[model samples]
Structure formats: C-alpha cells, structure tokens
Target: GEAGRAAALEGLERKVKAAMRSTTLNRLAPDLEALVRAETIAVQAGPRPSADESVLAEIRGAVLAGRPLSFIYSRPGAEARSRSVAPCGVMFGRANYLVAADRESGRIQTFRLDRMTSVEAGDGLATPPADFDLAAFASQSFGIYQDEIEDVVLRVTPQGATEARGWRWHPTQTLEDQPDGSVVVRFRASGMRELAWHLFSWGEQVTIEAPQRLKAVMAGELAAAGRALSRAQS
Candidate 1:
C-alpha cells in the first residue's frame, strides 16, 4: 500500500515535471519554475505508500456503498487469512485501518490494512446502524480490536502524568491532578491489552483506579512474569 501511494505521488510529480518542460514560454517562466519547485518538494516530502491503495479504495467503497467486501487480512502478529465481511465502516487512525465487520461473534473485528492483500468487493450489502460512529467507536481504543466496553480509570504518578500529558493514546482521555503527585485518567474503551502492556512498561508508577478485573489481571501477569524470572535464575 505504501508503495502504491508512493507510486501515485511519483506519477503526479512526473506530470508536473512534464508540464513545466512543455511550457517554454519565457513570459510565464517565473511562476512555472516556482510551481515546479514546490511540486518537487511536496512529492519528496509525501509519505511513502506502505499500504495497497486498491485494497483501501475497494474496502472504503464497499463500506460506504453498503456492500460486503472480502480480503486476506491478518491481526497483529498473525498470519494472513481470507475473510468475508459485511463492513459497517472504515476507520483510519494509529497508522492502521479499522474495519467493523458483522459476524456470528457480537464483537466487531478490526483489520490492519498493511496486513491485507488481494481485497475484493461483493454485491451484497448491509446498512449499518444510524447511530454508529467510527470516531466515537475508537475514542478510547489503543489499537484496533474492541471487544468489551468498560470505563477504565487510571491514577498516574505526577512524574507519570507529566510523561502522559504530551502524548495522546486515546481521544477520550480525561486527566485530573491528584494531591499525592499523581493524575487520574478516565476513559471508556473495550480492548485493554495494549493499555495493559503500556502500564506494565511504567512499572509501579501508575495504578489502576477502577474495574478490579483488569487490575487483577494486570497484577497476575506481573506476578507470573516475576515468577518466571525467579525460576530462570534458580
């Protein structure tokens, strides 16, 4: 996809160059030269296509047209597999495409565009709920897959909060200062794996404030990791 987008940009650059070359009139030389330089610079600065544009285009068209699109897609750290999906919509964020698919499982499945290949659109269509909003859907998500929605509150130490303030992991993140040199972040999200992983990276600087289930899971994971390390040395 990156290659395809880059190639498309390159094609535009060539056209601009050809136009500049074809226009030999000295009267418009100054403006044409400036335009040519600008085009060249823009082309150079454009992001390289890391995804297949055709796949993106086809998927997007199908979603908007209310048709089912099929493709070979893979999850993070997974092998690509063929999937037929009734796409509710397409979302672009976190440098990946999030597609809502209707399946026997009530939870929606998210797909990474870079992992998709040979995407095709089918004629069958399904209208998504009028209330469905992709942006709102991803407001609290860290990556793609959203399984179970819940309100997750986290208390970050002042130092941790300071580090988190500059970066936005979720759009719905709400921050509040704490007296004990910490901050509380309140947000609603479904998938917590990525966030759990992020919290683990912070060590003990942050603490889970709500949803005892997640906190317990996180604690268990850390405890198991500690035991694994202890066993390795013993």
Candidate 2:
C-alpha cells in the first residue's frame, strides 16, 4: 500500500515537472527546475510494499462502499476464527488496523490487518453508525491493547525536559513546563501494562505523578522482570 501511494505521488510529480518544463519560458527554467528538484527529493521518503495487499484492498473497498466484510483471522495462542463485521474505517500508523463494528457484539472493534488471513465482501452493505469517530476510538488507548482507561500523569526531571518536550506521548497529551525547568505531561489513556513498559525506556528521568494503579503496575512489571532474570541465571 505504501509502495502504491509512493508510486502515485511520484507519477504526479513527473506530470507536474513535464508541464513546468514545457510551459515556462527559458528565462524562468532554471528557477523552476531548482524548485522542482527540491520538492521531488522531499517527497521521496522511504515506503515499502504491503505483505497482504489484496486482503487490505478487499476490506478497504468494503469500508468505502458502506459494506460488511467477512474475514478469517488468526493470532498466536488463539484459534483461527471467522468474523463478519460492518466496516467502519481503516487506520494506518506503526501498524495498520481495521476499525469496524462487530456483527455479533454490535460494538466497535479494531483488528490488525496482517492478522487477517483472508478478507472478502459480505452480502449486504451496512453503514457505520453516524456517532462513530475513528480517531477518537483509536486515541482511547495509550497503545493498541484495550484496557481500563485512566488519567495518566508523568513528571519529567529537568534533565529530561528538553527531550520530553519533543516526544509525543498521545494524541490528547498535555505538556506543561514547570517553573523549575521540569515538565509534566498528562493524558487519559488505556492499556496500563503497555504504558508501564513504555515508561521503562524513560528510566529514572520520569516519575508517575497520578493514578496509583499505574505506579502499582510499573512495580509489578519490575518485580516480574527481576524474577525472570533470576530464573534465567539459575
């Protein structure tokens, strides 16, 4: 999918360059060529081909057409299951996700696109609920895992403020610069375990300021990790 999008962008760039070359007078050619070269290079960020392009296309077309879709899904430690869903929207980021309404539960669900073994159009078209907001749904979680949502607050030390200011923790994150040169970032999010794992990267630079549950989870994670290390050494 990325490859296709890149190719399309490249093709349009070529057309624009050809038109500019043919229409501009000789006096303006050098300036126009220089601008074109700069933009062309800027647009050439690396993108790769999708592993399951056809399956993605099937679900994408269904979502666009307000149609339902059926797919065979599988993941580690789980039985391969078949599902029918009312396609709502598709989200692409670090990994692609299919945001849809489950036919049985009638609740919105997110599916990893790569986990889908096969996808096809279902019989009747089903329009997504008017109240559904794909962006809001995805932002409900700190990471992809869906869990109890909590108000998360982190206090970054003065030493980590510069780097923390540049880091985006969530779509709804709020960063406040303290008078002491430290920074406090707050965001309401789900996936506590995932958040704890991410905070490990910040190490001693960050402290959990709110949500006692988050601090507990972080301690549990460290304890479990220590036990694992001990077992491995034994």
In terms of TM-score, which candidate is strongest? Answer: 2
Instruction: Name the 10 consecutive residues with the lowest summed lDDT in model 2.
Output: 41-50
Model 2 lDDT tens row, 60-89: 789888888998989889999998899987
Highest lDDT model number: 2
RMSD values, in order shown: 6.5, 4.5
Model 1 Cα displacement at 212 (Å)? 1.5
lDDT of 2: 0.83
TM-score, per-candidate, Cα-based: 0.68, 0.79
Pairs that collide in candidate 2 are: none
Which portions of model 1 miss their true places by more than 4 Å?
A: 8-50, 72-82, 93-95, 103-107, 114-118, 223-234
lDDT score of residue 77 within candidate 2: 98
